[model samples]
Target: MAQFPPVPDTLNYIFCNTPADFHNAVWVLRHHPYLILDCEGHDLGRAGGCVTLVCVGTPLAEHIFLFDVISPHLSRYDIDALLNLFNDRNILKVVWDGRMDYLELWSTYGVSLENVLDLQVAEVVSRGVVRGEGEIQRMKRLQQSYISTQVSDRLGARLDGLHAVIGLQRCWKECGFPAGNGKDPAVVKMHKSIGSRMWVERPLTEQLLQYAAKDILLIGILYAQFSKQGWIPRLPSDYYYLLGQCQRYVSAHREQGKSAAVDAFKPCQIMPLDVLDHPVGPKYRCNACHRYLSLATYETVQGVAPRQASTSEVPRITTLRRPRCRLCQILALRAGFRMDQTYLVT
Candidate 1:
């Protein structure tokens, strides 16, 4: 028989379904200022799908608690406390690729996730990758780059398509955390095959429980490493702002399912107008929508453009040109207005 490591005693894997267990988990979480969050849901494509499990991992306590939101044993108070944690601004909630999690949480709980720090978003901003480069900037790639320095290219490439934390377990192991108690490659492949159906399984197996706990545990470790590397400070201010906007956009889309609103929520960058002025090219791409447009699409501000001298005797004069596109400006204004309304209502 192949020998495997024992589950670490330091990791408290609490499954909260009863009031006592739920309250105990909440109490432990209240003391921690930061938490790594991940959600598991079923029927993801339909409106009926809801957040089934919420995993909260605290690095300080070295504990990961799994909350059974759909379990019949849970009471309204237990659910309310869990939702309150998501809304708490004092506790920084860290997630990797939180778009679907945010949407599902809003759809199921009618609560907004506040003070969120997305590791995937931070990774993109740190790399300074151009927008629309989704194929390259994936969570597994980020994990391999930042956490698992020893992973081979072939294995890392294979893990790119997987959406689970099992892909990053090696990274956690390298970081000295016991992450792969039940996450062998064969087991991970089995779990991935089931996809969203894991939520429907009753009397959750120990392997599944370990898998859920490890997701947030790895997130917590990656967050610490990111902070140590000073990547957190290097992230642009708009990234944080965009996270909130994204949550709102998800909420709005879930409620209304409008394409226009979702499109408006697309990530955008505001660069200085001078960066857009290329002598060789007349067309420029909008930093927000990533759309290439003519000069007419942009709104001109009174700014100095480089002037060419006609002759040796002629002196150069500065000219004005449109710096920012009009569509982005409109979208920004609308987003701000919507944010203001959300604040007032909240």
Candidate 2:
């Protein structure tokens, strides 16, 4: 069996359900400058689905509180106190992929998560950064690890795909953490088998609770490691750029109908915006993805037009363009169906 990242046994995990428990949890949680956050639910962030668990871990994974918002014993006030932490800019909420969590929080409780740092975005952005290693060598290793050479031979083709979002488990392994007892294969296998029911099923088993705790633990550890290596963006401009990206991710789901699923895996889904923000040729809207993408994202052909003829008597040059971005084009080829090109221009 493959090794799993070790979670320390000494990790303090509290399942807060009753009023007193929630009150105590909130008091302790608010004291932290930053908290690692994760959520589990049945079809969470979607119509007909609801958030079942909210996991918050202190820095260094000292104490992890599993807040049971669905518990009848906990009043709205207790839940609100905990959610106030989400709105507090003074307390940072470090998350892996927080899109659904943000959307569900707003749609269900009217809370807008503030001071968020999405680690998934940080990981994608880190591919472009080289700390101690030589730039060329570091990029090569990153490409080998995270990107598919078949995608494109272009340098850093990995940056172009929203599919590059790395899951927390893979991120944990990549960070070089050792296998621990909490990562026992049986426990993991059981958790996956539970699927959506894992969160909604009352009286969550110890194995499931530990699984939830592991997520926040991983988030906290990743933030610490990324911070030490300077992977998390800290400059005012870069910071806001990331914040905007996180907000955009959440907003993508806001207007979505209850049954409508946000297809995160679609090639046309948004990638980190900064990667495509380069100053280059004017962007053209992809007929498939409907996103304004740079020239590099499409297939181009040169053509001569009599109307565009230059004053020097050269035929006016024009480029025949493809209807879709390269990524979406490939997807259409494999999927054997094309999405409607109709989209309102923003």
- Which candidate has the top score in TM-score? 2
Full-model lDDT for every candidate: 0.57, 0.68
Worst 10 residues of 1 by lDDT: 337-346
lDDT of 1: 0.57
Residues forming the 10-long window of minimal summed lDDT in candidate 2: 265-274
Per-residue error (Å), model 2, residue 243: 3.6
Q: Which residue pairs in candidate 1 collide?
A: none
Model 1 per-residue lDDT tens digits across residues 133-193: 4644454453444324333242343333222222246544544555445245554787568
TM-score for candidate 2, please give it. Answer: 0.70
Candidate 1 wrongly placed segments (more than 4 Å): 1-11, 43-46, 129-184, 234-346
Q: By TM-score, how accurate is candidate 1?
A: 0.56
Off by over 4 Å in 2: 1-6, 131-163, 179-184, 234-237, 257-334, 339-346
TM of each candidate vs. truth = 0.56, 0.70
RMSD of each: 13.3, 6.5
